[model samples]
Target: MSGHSHWANIQHKKGAADNKRGKVFSKLARYIMIAAKNGGGDPAMNLPLRYAIEKARSVSMPKDNIERAVKKGCGENGGVTFDEIAYEGFGPGGSAIFVDILTDNRSRTNGEVRKIFEKGGGNMGGPGCTAHMFDRKGLLQVPALAVDEDALMELALEAGADDVERLGDLFEIRCDPTAFQAVRDALAKANLSTTMAEMTRLPKDPMDVDAEMGRKIIRLLEALDDHDDVQSVYTNAKVTEEMMGS
Candidate 1:
């Protein structure tokens, strides 16, 4: 765990993601709506809806809120339509930043994101700028002490994971995006708990940066993530726990 793994763990410990629960719920609702509208309101028939519902439920989102979003998506309740967009850019030390966005107002979000990048010591780029540098995959985070490494690896690999990596006190399980749910179900059957699980873009090349530059890169990531429309942000800047003051 160097860039994303380290940063995610640190953020989890800091309660950074949970601190903005209201914003999280709203973003998740948008995710559900889009998934439902694209496919159908039934999770059994819609894979994306199932994933979205699971994520919302993971965060303890109210059942009524989820139902209403489903209704809105199915045209029972009027609501704003959102577009899925990806923003690619460069942060301090030439580190790559990839942002996943869901928004009803593209023009407004575009302007705000550009300013965020500039203010955080970075610059926004056109499509395929930094996006080509990453591969979309499923990543699962687990504490080292939670399970035996060899046993966990065997189970994950048997269930379709590409590999299991041991990084300090953390374990990262990487798998093909399509196999994510299978691997997750396998772990659950074995009574294992994961701290974080998501399909994300992983950097092809991790960039080494000094502490000062790393700090700048993280600030840019934080700012982008704080935005209402930004759902997720990925980076390639390599920094240590001590350097990030984790």
Candidate 2:
């Protein structure tokens, strides 16, 4: 139902500018380990672990690496603990930004994140600042060329999805977080493949920006995402490749 597509940001993130594959893998492993530790390694019984594993596989994380992380988290190896934190802020164009973080030392990570925000022309805010601008939901992105629209709509809706609509070249299936598994399972069973699937936050009001503002917002978001402790970055701004000026 939304006109703004997150596909542009998704495309930007696929760039290898400064994101080394090893560092990306390490971050995903942390996610997997924490999920497996909190809940058992069984993805069926553990929704968080299922999401973590799905993210890992999306990045092509090795099977051996994923199994090792699960074992490590299950206490087969020494247990390491991490704290989950959410950082909120406003970008150059007043776009709301939300960052997910996983860190062992909150103080250090906080300082680092704040510095990144500042250097990128933004300021990190206290709790509940930017969070109110977004809604947590399940987003499954399927390429338009992949499946028939009516079929996807029927299958997704029957599986408890809230809505299904074409966003640019992709069909986005939206659902409540609780229904994500059911919807995902339904798609899997029907052999309908997705380009991307995840539990994510969608902006309540999509931010519109000029080319200059779009460049600044995208830079700030990319900087936040590249941090070692940062897990994910979400923004309300709709930035296209053309807006990322040099």
Candidate 3:
């Protein structure tokens, strides 16, 4: 697996822990609200909202909570409006970092994120500094046991996917941003369930970090992820199983 995929798998495992604490629900709701606000309340007409709803359902978020978030975004109920923001920076061992945020107060969110970076041995960089090193793409992961590799590859290629990679027990599918939903629908039609499907920033060149630096980078990432305004954190830092277990 690539460093990015490895870290993603680790986060997928940690998602269970986050759900137990109810943090995952909060984050998922925020995403749903934002998606609804941007693309309207109907999931059928709004691809992003449909994606957010699927993610929330996978985490077992209550239907009522999801409905409330969508209503709030549609202004059926008074709720704080969120603004999307992205922050780029460098972390321990010169690892490239990208943070996606949704917040009502940019000033406060910016200060808090900057403080987290400094406290965790990283320094925030100007916009586009680290972002230029990455490309945004639709990523989908299907369990290897779900279907035969050859069959899956043919299906994905026919669905307009760019590349498909075998990673241990999973197959990672990459696709153009505009074709993400179509590709996902095609996979579903093939009877293959996805483990994860999301738009993400993939780094062109990953930075390797020793165990010590890896641990520090993970800590920084966890802190950022825990913030209510922060949606996702992307980094190029590589971690070994030993480092993650530590």
Q: Largest TM-score belongs to which candidate?
A: 3
In Å, residue 54's CA in model 1 sits off its true spot by 1.5
Please give the distance, in angstroms, between residue 98's alpha carbon in candidate 1 and its true position after superposition.
0.9
RMSD, every candidate, angstroms: 2.3, 2.1, 1.5
Q: Candidate 1 has which clashing residue pairs, if any?
A: none
After TM-score superposition, what is the CA distance of residue 142 in candidate 3 from its true location, in Å?
1.3
Residue-pair clash count for candidate 3 = 0
Badly placed stretches (over 4 Å) of model 2 are 3-20
What does candidate 2's lDDT look like per residue over 1-246, in tens digits? Answer: 474456334642553333355777888789998898899888889989989998778767789999999888787878758778899988786788899898999999999999998998889999999999888888887889888999999999999999999977889888999999899999899887877787788888887788888888878887888888988888888777776645
Please report, as a residue range, the 10-residue window in candidate 2 with the lowest summed lDDT: 11-20
Per-residue accuracy of model 1 over 1-246 as CA lDDT, tens digit each: 345456555544433355355777887888899899999899999988998898788777899999999988887778548899999899887888899999999999999999999998899999999988887888887889999999999999999998899887778998889899999999889888887777777777778888888877887887888898988888877755566543
Taken over the whole model, the C-alpha lDDT of each candidate is: 0.82, 0.82, 0.86
How many clashes does the backbone of model 1 have?
0
Off-target runs (Cα >4 Å) in candidate 1 are 1-4, 10-21, 240-246
Better of 2 and 3 by lDDT: 3
lDDT of 2: 0.82
